[model samples]
Target: MKKPFRKKRQGGFTLLQFALVVLVSSIVSAVALNRFEYYREQAEIAAARQVVASLRTSLQARAAQLLSTGRERELQQLASANPMNLLLWKPENYLGEYYAPDPQQIGGAGWVFDPRDRSLVYLPRNARSFSFGSSKLLRFKVEFVRISNKSLALNQVSG
Candidate 1:
């Protein structure tokens, strides 16, 4: 007698196929994570640049006001003062004035004015890829600079 025909078996992925899929998935995940971290660092740097630009503009405006009021001598004082004070609104990342800020205490990407050093410091959250030379913190100081024979300007000097 002839035997009856049967359909072929259909099942889920085999062990080898499953392992390959997992390996590819993990590789993609790792690459995506690294890219995300890189973008985050770039964003932090851009935000810092924007804040610095705003600060320079505010410093110039304050200096101009003082000059108009005939207080040019007082312009020198701006060099040591907290530049954040000149802004109408302080950035949310600003941690206010600190005499000697401890990096461990500040803990993340933000701004702090060190009264002792008379410098504005920026702490990066993603500092691993950034090259800050000997120090990880970026510091800036405001100073009056003579640009021309009859012109004076308030400028931000990186420290």
Candidate 2:
């Protein structure tokens, strides 16, 4: 008597197939994570740059007003009251000081005036603060350079 026919069985994936799928997925996830991190950093850098630009414009406008109005003494007083006014234009490391100029503090450390060009320079602390949500805080440096009136004119500097 002939034996009943046996049937072949094929259903779930083999071990090799499962491992390949897992490996591919892990690689894809890693690449995606790396790209995301790069974009985050780029965004942070751009924000920092924008803050610097705004500060520069503000300082320049103030300087021009003082020069055009012949408010040298007031400017000096303001500088003395807030030394950071000068240093804010210069590119430097953040030091955490944001005092406005005062007459008494004029011509001190972190403050310099170009007599020939009639420009003042200083550095201020907390010039730029970047936050990622409520978690991270980043600080940036700012530099100020005041050229003489003649040089300023030649360069067509605008406030």
Candidate 3:
């Protein structure tokens, strides 16, 4: 009668069960970390693309204003501006530093705005030199192009 009344009591979980729990949690965490990294890269790339889009839209708007508002002469001048001077400097170089950064700006990642192609080219300053133009590679290690806008200062401009 006493043996029948006694209940078999089990001690907590086995070692194998604990180990499996830990393994499952670690695998879940690893997968989550990988997902976070992928999304982070995508966000950074999108930010760079927005930079290109803003530049393109601004150039087109300025050109259209100049062409339609009795400022055709100025628009024509910009259209004929030298490519080296335009991308290298700007339509009005003396107005301000518009083509690239002050060269002393933070990161020194000097950029060139190609109004013709609606591209914001990132021309990084080399470690060997402080000048952004020091490397005549004529290629950007990273560049983004905007496809929606037309070239600025065109012969005919429309909204």
Candidate 4:
């Protein structure tokens, strides 16, 4: 008795070809993901800026309303007061009524106002990961544009 030999059939992808394709695609994927993460962070930063702008507008509007009337003493107090510490407890004040700053409203950034310089500050919760002097440096710089009684100017961040 005699047996006959048969040839093997070829497949779609060989081991080395598959490995090369996977390696190339993985490197490309890594680069794309890195870019995507950067864009996402930028978006978060932009959202934070917008939130600060809204808050500044409200504060300026209130300040204008207060200054327009003959309530200099009360307006002075409100300007010097911290919106969060007092407004959270009491929304109504001599300047006018306003809501408190809620972190949840601004994606968890703790909102604080510096009456000395009149700058609205917003720092991401993950502040430590930003810069070397993250404690002293503000990742986002907010400007009230104008706090006069004519019209409220939205806050703009200095880049």
Candidate 5:
């Protein structure tokens, strides 16, 4: 007696196919995450730079006004009236403090001045060593070396 014979075929993907899919997905995810981190770091750096630039401009404008009008006291008053306590200029406390001032007050971080040396410092969210250089003549440079939870250093120079 001859009976009909039939073979059933596999219905789903093989183990190798599944593994390849997973591998590809993992690679894609890793790339995305890396790109996200890079962008995040770049944004932080840009923000820090912007803060430095704004402070430099303000200081230069104020200094020029003071020299032209001989209103040194007005400039002092402007510095003192900083909305954030971070701008308390003192030689002993070069890194005065860090305050996230209202956006309307100051777009980014706060800053202090060393009236003696005419050097400007930009304080980050914490009392770290994040600072920039500014002279009475408005010449300035902003540096960023590293930033962490507790300490920050502006030891890098960029052209």
Candidate 6:
């Protein structure tokens, strides 16, 4: 007896299967991109905070040295000067001292000292989640605050 012939099945994915795979891949990519951005912003914020903490400590140490050396009158000047100068090792991102950096000159995430305003400006390169308010740069100033009845401390202020 003769056997009946049967059609051969295709070897590749069907059109609908291919479409589904592409859609799933695109979704995964989008979600991954969003998460990556969030983590990047968080890391930037943490690094900035570390720099600020170091600055505060250095300021206090310098003030103490001044007091010990009978240069108490110069503490006020120290508070007004560039805080970065007190750092034994500056961050790699620091763009160095700038009187008043032109917007066109500074274009990236880094630290800069603007003596004109007596503020340290942090220019965020990838600031998707940072709270910059009205401007892209986050500004901080160093000032002396009374910690107790007879003691003062150096602190960083956004204002």
Top TM-score model? 1
lDDT of 4 by residue, 41-111 (tens): 67656665555555565666576677678665565555445544332232221122114333355454444
What does candidate 1's lDDT look like per residue over 27-114, in tens digits?
9999999999889888888888899898888887877888888887777787678888988899889987777777688775689998
**TM-score, per-candidate, Cα-based:** 0.85, 0.46, 0.46, 0.56, 0.46, 0.82
Candidate 3, lDDT over the whole model: 0.45
Which lDDT value does model 5 have at 83?
19
- The per-model lDDT (C-alpha) reads 0.78, 0.46, 0.45, 0.51, 0.44, 0.78
> What lDDT tens digits, residue by residue, belong to model 2 across residues 1-159?
999998989799899999999999999999999998777666655654554465556656676788788875555444333323544454343233333333244433233333333333332222233333332323222233465651111111221
Predicted candidate 3 versus true structure: per-residue lDDT over 34-81, tens digit per residue: 998767655544544444454445556656677577675665455444
lDDT of 6 by residue, 139-159 (tens): 888766665522335444453
Question: Which lDDT value does model 3 have at 88?
Answer: 31
Better of 3 and 4 by TM-score: 4
2 or 6, which is superior by lDDT?
A: 6
TM-score of 1: 0.85
Show the lowest summed lDDT stretch of 10 residues, model 3: 136-145
Error of 1 at 62 (Å): 1.4
Q: In model 4, where do residues sit more than 4 Å from their true spots? A: 1-10, 84-121, 125-159
**Candidate 4 lDDT score relative to the true structure:** 0.51
Which regions of candidate 6 are displaced past 4 Å?
2-7, 126-128, 132-136, 148-159
lDDT digits (tens) for residues 28-121 of candidate 5: 9999999987676566556655655445555555556665777655545554443122223322323333242232344444344434333444
What's the CA RMSD for each of the models?
Answer: 2.5, 12.1, 11.0, 8.3, 12.6, 2.7
The total number of steric clashes, by the backbone 3 Å criterion, in model 4 comes to 0
Worst 10 residues of 5 by lDDT: 150-159
